[model samples]
Target: MTYFNDFDINENIKKAIKEMGFEEPSPIQEKAIPEILSGRDLIGQAQTGTGKTAAFGIPLINQITTAPHVQTIILTPTRELAIQVSGELQKLSKYMKIRTLPIYGGQSIGHQIRALKQGVQIVIGTPGRIQDHLRRKTLRLDKVRAVVLDEADEMLDMGFIDDIENILKQVNTDRKTLLFSATMPPAIRKLSRRYMNSPVTVSINKSEVTAPSIDQVYFKVLERNKQESLCRILDSKDPELGIIFCRTKKGVAELTEALQARGYLADGLHGDLTQSQRDAVMKKFRDSSIEFLVATDVAARGIDVNDVSHVINYDIPQDPESYVHRIGRTGRAGKSGEALTLVTPREMKHLRSIEAEIKMAIPSHAVPSIEEVVEKQQQSWKNLITDQLNDDEDLSLFNALTEELLEQYEAKDIVRSLMKLNFSSAIGESDDGYNFGETGGAKGMIRFFINVGRNVNMSPKVLIEEISNAVGIPGKAVGRIDIFENFTFVEVPEDVAPFVYEALRYSRINGARVNLEPAKPRPKRENRPRPARPSR
Candidate 1:
């Protein structure tokens, strides 16, 4: 489909697309939307950047009616993604009358239940929270016209296969099933075969996965130095329009606040923000009022801009496909763009995996030193002066002061003094004054204490292997592992700590369920009772 109007979609959908600034369908949307509209089971193999959410959202919303029972439900792997899908559906159903609600774990269940009782037509949620509603009989799925498994592979990786099976079984057998994922692993394939009815697969070729116009590179920096390195890169690139991608909502908020405190024109977007708040932030970003937009992967999916010169990954993307999506925000509409990733020493292995899967060798580069950054800024400063001189603006207001200063000091000295005034505020912005707060571990690591150890046959090797398999992260990313007689202390990357926690909270180790929590500060040795000395 060349244009959204070319397809046999609802008039309201076309109107919403126009309002949302999209005139045409992406490759994935072009293929998937028609099949979905035809009421057949669909298996869409496309990443986030290809507009897969809208691909399914358009048809799903088009078919669903404002019924008393839920007519459509979308299952996403993360809370943020669930909210993103709900927001996208809200836009697509703007001209129509429909109610969409996103239910996830952190929010109060009573609030969700109250909203559910008000008769919502569409529900989007994470698997765990959806399961809670299912157990409570709050979600009515008997009238469901369609079911969408957004990011199927991500759900499988997060150990939600059983939950998915349970939820699918509750929906009526005649409903359409749609599964969208970046890759079709064996588990996801098995799932589709068992649950779907003659599903048609839509995939974008490898060549279309990423653009060649993007100049990609990676930098190895300690976790403590990530913000500092990002600042240096920002000063060096001076992108006209830039977006910084972070993985978690907390990361987005924290990074946005940090950049703002440092005098950068930056704002953040995440699921936590209200719709009006998101609109304000995006409006600022589009009109160039904000130079850098710090956002998560899903939150930035709908961002369509042509002049974005750079995309910085403050926290490395978890997958190659997500890397493609993150960088795709830039390099739009035939303009060249640059992308940079910051990796910790332990994350280099994961970075290599992304490189191998993406089939591109992201060259390594050192973070610009303070001296190098200053030199580049000095050149830029000179260019600014040249441009000002070319503008032919009158300088009579400052002429008398310049003359007085010129009489007191050499002309070169006068210029140097101006330089000092310009650069003094920004000097050594991160040298010793930077705050890298303690995260219960060494820099870049968050130490977690699991309530299972040698008592349940746990060992360092077993712990590392089990965690790696459970969370889909490299064993190296699991930092130092120390197994005690009854408990264990393990360190993991700060960025990945949440995933580990979520994946392992209800998980079993050595055939016994385990509990995981952040390690509290160890008390002074004297605060503990002295152990009895064993007889020699």
Candidate 2:
């Protein structure tokens, strides 16, 4: 029942927040904003998507005056987070004429320097780039009144702790410091202890911190088959509005292209997009014009859209807490929503850790079949036809066309032709019913069988990586890998198979020596006839 008014934020900021349609302050924002505004150093413990950006941004903006230049700097772990935080701060400060710039790699440093020279009030940057600017003397923090270490644990995990420490040292010694992280690891605690000045510690309850409405599920899939399997599942579930989480911005773009090629209304969100472009994509998604959003975790943060039906993990998150945050996009406001995770064999331990932390075992679900997709499409078409028939308007035009066609062709024939056209167009032409061979890689490829299978928890991803690394072949050069319990079958270019065999002869994965040999065709079991004696 608590709301944003309790924070007593500036009227302009509050108005902007209201226009953004946020009524309640998330627990972390509620507890941390006031303390941050009181000129006290604070440590906020909260998870992603908890409105942490506004929590820190509101107070930071309130303290800055139009006269002071670049008086606040926020350090984030990834470039995506840097851009996202900067944009959110800009939105919250729209009425105040406060200038904020996001500085990170993959962008023109010369442009950042120009922006810095223009006397921006706040700089939000990734640690490495911030350090680069500091070393170049393009960034001057002498007048910085406050510094925020956002996602402190992520910075530590990413080995940016040293960069953060260096940046902190460069800022004004008397500056107020605020640290926010999802978890309080000892490393984060130590960093805070060294930098913060008797900071007030505010912790939102862990259960309340995570979205409880998300129903999480994981599918054990081989790495090579993941792309195909994911396409199938997407076709099966057909979420109305959803986001697929990938690990990197490159991955986001790659997946977005792949999804769009498959005829899905999907778009990528990442640090690479300009502010206007990102705004356009988010607007389309929120308005239901875009069905799927492919994004990295950092880029997806601070997204507060409702009615997302699903959140999918295209790759397993590196940490358990990230799994929690990715799926939290769906199943909100007492509505049931689904979260699907694709996990490789080696990542089962990571999945178990997530289950232990969340105290829920995500049920194992079968990958949807191509036939099932066809069936769903057919049903949907039938429903559409039925809905049209129920409409009160006259159908004289359609009826006349039907009658003319019926005069030349029997009703069954016309119907069959129409059905064929509809189904063929929907499913597209099949490439000779071959699974892996359609790409022309199956011709000269020799299949190798390894003695690891379902029993040993072998997955396609691990098998492909091991084979690729051991044989010095690129991952894409290796073909299909089928994992069965106690064994796996991998395809390699026939020319490279000999080299692969020699290379992996002594390789061991998970403490078991990998046995490799030519893959044998599976034997088909013969059905036996009932004995004649039974009739007697």
Candidate 3:
């Protein structure tokens, strides 16, 4: 079971593996393949980029025959992963001439129907699309022998659990089912308990969950200034291969466009990409042509690249585990890498959670300055020039031209002009000038004056607890409390202000109507004559 050759795989599958240039099996494949080929249900706990597709795919494809019905269904969380898994399956089944179809939303249903009519042995699709096909009766699971759920946890996160349950119900309970996820959440465990029978559980250790070499870091920045800060960091780090993680597909597209407009060789990877488009983008990324890849969490899950130097979190991930996975792209193969996360003030709690889970403190760092970016660029150019000088090449013509120019102008002048031409134009506007407003700094606290005070039987402690319970703000961030006859004033962190404001805007406090607004500046107290030098 340590090798794929140990299994009773067909010749065509072996040939396909050989053609695909896969000789040794990955750890997951080495362990899970044999169990799956033995017709046992499996629950694999492993991260993406671990070759889980082949672990489940090879056995499933080997089981597929010349039957016209769909014998295997692979469900993925996103459309991009669906197409990617289907393409891998097709490649793995190439020698057997197995027919595989990818079905997902945002595509023509009629086309899917036509392809289904043509008889696909395997169908890879998303939950919503698969449910649609099931409703239309365009897909049949009666003959299905194997079902694979890739990134099952992600599917649950997207609220597709019900659809997944329905799809599993449609499949034969006696058939082999495989569920793979990075983390085993409670819901997934419950599903396996209910649907799978005596399933063999294979768990890859968390140390091996992601590349250990990937260096991870996070930065706290205002949401409005995230783009500017990201550009500054990228300019300063200047990664040869990098990826920026966003939350949505639209975010990917927009960020990719913005990066490209600024002269970076970047591209978007998301569910919207066609198979061919995805291939092109990955090709560029692999060939070192594209330096920046903007992608969502699900779309970028399966990407395995060794040369990536940095990973940027454009949006603070919803979960701490996702942050780990997103940054695992870099620092691979014993290489030192960098990861940066852009977080807003409100999201600091999430950041703290990540730190608590990882058991490591991510040191806070300031965004790079424009001058630093220019210095880094110049250093890179200097390195490039040094390499060129060291290379054995015919530079007689260039040397002669340089000598001629040196005679007309001083060498320093010529170098200065050349540097200006090569590097000055590349320096972009500095992000330091970009204002995220006063809401960014901790100094800017939200001030709200309440109409309940000592006269109305109110204390700061009660008011603090009430506001905290009502708007979800902790008491620690609630600043100074001032009590007056008719009103009380309190300060909250700026980031939490908007939410507290909206929550209390129309709500009554202590059964009395209240008003919330920016706190008025406290009037300066004047010193009266020291009590007439008094009674001392």
Best by TM-score: 3
Clashing pairs in 3: none
TM-score for all models, in order of appearance = 0.59, 0.63, 0.64
Better-scoring candidate (lDDT), 1 or 2: 1
Off by over 4 Å in 2: 106-114, 157-159, 184-186, 218-229, 245-262, 265-309, 329-337, 343-350, 363-372, 379-536
Of the candidates shown, which would achieve the greatest lDDT relative to the real structure? 1
lDDT at residue 210 of model 2 (Cα atoms): 48
Model 2: colliding residue pairs: 223-461, 452-487, 453-484, 453-485, 453-486, 453-487, 454-484, 454-485, 455-485
Candidate 3 deviant stretches above 4 angstroms = 217-229, 247-261, 265-291, 295-309, 328-338, 342-372, 379-536
lDDT of 1 by residue, 39-147 (tens): 8999999865567888889888888776767899899887657777788889899988899999987789999999999989999999999999999998878888899
In lDDT terms, how accurate is model 1? 0.81
Clashes of each: 0, 9, 0
- State candidate 2's TM-score: 0.63
Model 1 RMSD in angstroms:
12.9
User: Order of candidates by TM-score, top first?
Assistant: 3, 2, 1
Runs off by more than 4 Å, candidate 1: 106-111, 157-159, 212-230, 240-309, 314-319, 329-337, 342-356, 359-418, 421-536
TM-score of model 1 relative to the true fold? 0.59
lDDT of 2 by residue, 246-279 (tens): 9999889988997787678999999788867887
